[model samples]
Target chain A: MSLGEFELIGRYFRSMELGNAGGSEHVTLGIGDDAALISMAPDKQLVVSTDTVVLGTHFPPDYIPANLAYRALAAAVSDLAAMGARPLSFTLALTLPEVDETWLQSFAQGLTDAARDHRISLIGGDTTRGPLNINVTVLGEVRPRNVVRRGDAQPGDLLCVGGPLGDGGGGLAVVLGESMPSSVSDAARDYLFQRFWRPLAQCELGLELAGVASAGLDVSDGLIADARHLAEASGVALHIRLADLPCSAALQAWPEAQRMEWMLGGGDDYVLLFTLPVASIRCLEVWASQGFDVTVIGEAVVGSGIWLDDGQELKEKVQPAGYQHFQRKSND
Target chain B: MSLGEFELIGRYFRSMELGNAGGSEHVTLGIGDDAALISMAPDKQLVVSTDTVVLGTHFPPDYIPANLAYRALAAAVSDLAAMGARPLSFTLALTLPEVDETWLQSFAQGLTDAARDHRISLIGGDTTRGPLNINVTVLGEVRPRNVVRRGDAQPGDLLCVGGPLGDGGGGLAVVLGESMPSSVSDAARDYLFQRFWRPLAQCELGLELAGVASAGLDVSDGLIADARHLAEASGVALHIRLADLPCSAALQAWPEAQRMEWMLGGGDDYVLLFTLPVASIRCLEVWASQGFDVTVIGEAVVGSGIWLDDGQELKEKVQPAGYQHFQRKSND
Candidate 1:
């Protein structure tokens, strides 16, 4: 019989352990048991989130297995970053049409690399036979009082982003051959592609913002939509200065309208959006000096919905619609 | 937009909390946030397991939504029982083809009931748009020293089962219209069907067996196959008595050959199969007296593989192949 689920896991996934960041010390028992045993840190509350990536729905079908694995892990772990939590471990439920040795090796390598970099261990998971689908449940921990929450945003708090926007969406558009800027440089195109294929979680910046920021969330479902999520949760309005959006050099090559669309509607950016008082400007300057792309985009106000403004005379009430699943076909 | 992923989750899944499972005491923050926060119990190691059920692979597409939800949760939580852990909380990643309110309501109701009965809170999960898939990551807790592992069996250990098996397979056969026994009563047929749709996790029994049993695992794939797994894990042989195999009244109504096949090869029973020392006979008696269907069906030996024996004189080596996904098309 071709490798059964158990044998496939044993061959490819069982030995992928965590290194650095306390190498598997948190795990009492790993795979090969009914369930993995995890030792939780005292004085820390466990933060848990799950995300599923369906083939053809989440990523392009032509993507390599390694890129797929990396993107999937990055997206899921990004939620922990939003919560300002330290990565602990994760479980993966993988369903595949068939077993491919080369694909498994590449995927495992990508997953192991990401897990190690994030200081998370592969505690336990399930492998089954079906249409390709990957569900990752990531576990992290943070001090109860220090956890950044979307509902904690306060009026007059400055809204900031840890990095640039629209790169992932631009990359996807270029990859799909639907929208391409004729004047875009080859380097810009390559950079955008890498942004989509392997986005950073901005976890360290999130940790830095834990006590400084009032509220935060990861920008996965586009800036406008995710900002609206924070606004609704915090029961406040977000007035965003469209001119202040930090767009990457690659994304800026697109037409103004196209660039705006990608900035507001792009998904998979995986950047942290947080709100903090003006007193945190010193912290922002420090981060900027340390080569982090931090930008103040707007401020929380005493109302609901989003208000968009330009540095010039242009001002408008923009509809907060982003890449919502079931409503949109793709991320952009 | 017809139900964005977030709205669907808020409408259908977010409210499905466990009332009896400490009423979210374990969850410091449930749902809504970027990630859920869970408070871990002290002096206990957490047990985590993930299982994904895909449409047209794990179950029949025509099955009711409620039954599907119940079976999925039961199967995932059964792993915790095998590990002798108390159910704490679970996260579900559900991907559906369309937004059907009736279907979501029914599924959520079934899932809620199961979670309440199992004492597991619905901490957090993800709802997305895609083909029908349900991935549940169950978290539980057990004392490290009392964990029932598959590798702890010893020679001369008495192998036992907590309850009868084969009803689920018979029920599945009936549901698929491949089996009809004239001698089976209506109640028998109903019992078999219920067994398949809502198998118990045997958590209470597993907890009781933790400190008393030498080794244990949930019987998911057929008895012969699961026994072989235990044997391999423990580096020993498991000798099972064919006549001693526990069969429910509903399953016994089938022909002798069919009954034997279902008992030995059927899957999804979710009963605990464990080994204990001969000195633990008193513990077995105590459990049996308290209405647990504990039965010593075999013994472990100082070798590998599984041996089947009939009370008379028949002895044979049984091939351990049962419910291997991709290898088998369906339960039958």
Candidate 2:
């Protein structure tokens, strides 16, 4: 017999723990009894964030359900990454048009694997009939060390990105008819595809950079728009050294125009865009031995508006400034 | 000329703050920020919970969109009520099919009203196109004081519900074609309909009964199902008194069979269902004089299963229970 939703969660979704809580902090609890108990911490503060991914909006139609599930968790985890909050747990609200057993098995397996990897529990959520949608709420804790905000960037702070800019957008291009991954070579294409589908939440980087990173946000809405947001919020001008933006081997192999488009306008890369004090650039190098390094792209200056240093008066109309639904479909 | 989603949120959704964070020594920063910063007393901990409501699944299809928004937030707030936690703040993930200008205005108005009424801030969330679904993650504070669990009920404890039962379900009867609201006329019918749509989260009662109530939960599913859950978790049996089950004036006037169905099977009444120490009932009565009242409907015993005092047997004819959406529709 096929297991019920409750039974499915009971067997696979329980027992995972995230945050220092590890299911012990008393702040949050997962499925088991009638209700979960949470014991608030004394010195630490709590940060809560939520995100939802509809089937065709956040992901491609051809995207596998398991991959979609992992990406859903990652999307919310990305919020924690932005807040420098150690995730305690997450509740998933999954709505599906149908309960295909095989699809559910794959989806639950992916959800369980991702939760275990992040140590976040599937506390409690609901399932219902609807078009495919997954809403995830992540509970996290922050220390006084820092809960980074987008408004904290100073005029002279160095603007940087934790990782690459637009592989997801490029991978999406490959998913649609506009581009071919084979153009970037098989292995590199595979790398970009996976990165686009199951982007990692840079939790460790967020925690480590909390004190040093002055202003930060997760790069869900293409780099240009998100960076514009950072600058607008911080009341500063952001200049991008098109040469300084990170890229994947696949993107490097693309034509200069195409590669730059992905970096500037692609969404769902799940990387961190942050700024740090100009003096901290030296500290960044000292921490480079930890296998993490960010290239300083520019500095925050007094003013607003983004500058593209590619020596072009225009570049594909700035990809219409992030993917807004009902505005238009993406052609990247 | 109407504001876009981002503009609407920026202009109106900002400046939302829960009482002053500076007034409390534990709160570091209140609202108008990415996340509210809070410090817990060395002895106190935080409780986090989430709840979701869909347009058609949790509420009637024809209910006003604004009322649905209000009720969705309340459903989630009720989780704090069950945990005996003080409401801090909540984040909302609202999914809608199309951006109806009038609908968005009404929905936001309802959301703001509910947040203001509850003294909780709308921290941050996402907006997207899909079936209408509202998911809220509520964060509250609690002491080590036995953070009530469904498993903690003792044999001699009194099964108490914070308020009357069945009004919500009876209201649903009026909503669906099942029955009419003959009991409560006109505006009162609208009131019952609103209550069924968005019942008040019993945060006050939860806080008052914290140390005294051994086990507690919010009754989203009917009394029988939720009671069965409490009994199973507490490792005891429950004998519910039909005579003692608190009935509202609206429900009391309904036909006996209809009321029974509504009270025992209808869900979405966010009242606190808990078992209190018999001795604490007196203290509870004292608080009742102040505002909140506790009604004893049954007793927990050293056995398993649920029994109704009506002297009739409950036979399980159907395998499935509340809020089911498992099977795929043939139409789909």
Clashes by residue pair, model 1: none
Tell me the native contact fraction for each prediction. 0.66, 0.40
Tens digits of per-residue lDDT, candidate 1, B118-185, equal 87888888776667788999988888888999999999999999899777678778676665868888
* Residue range with the least summed lDDT across 10 consecutive positions in model 2 chain A: A323-332
Q: Give per-residue CA lDDT, model 1, range A263-328, as digits (tens).
A: 877767899999997777688888988887889999999988777784222112324343333144
> Fnat of candidate 1, please?
0.66
Flag clash pairs in model 2. A17-A119, A18-A119, A26-A38, A26-A39, A27-A38, A27-A39, A39-B46, A40-B45, A40-B46
Model 2 residue-pair collision total: 9
Give the CA lDDT, 0 to 100, for residue A277 in model 2: 94
Each candidate's TM vs. the true structure? 0.93, 0.89
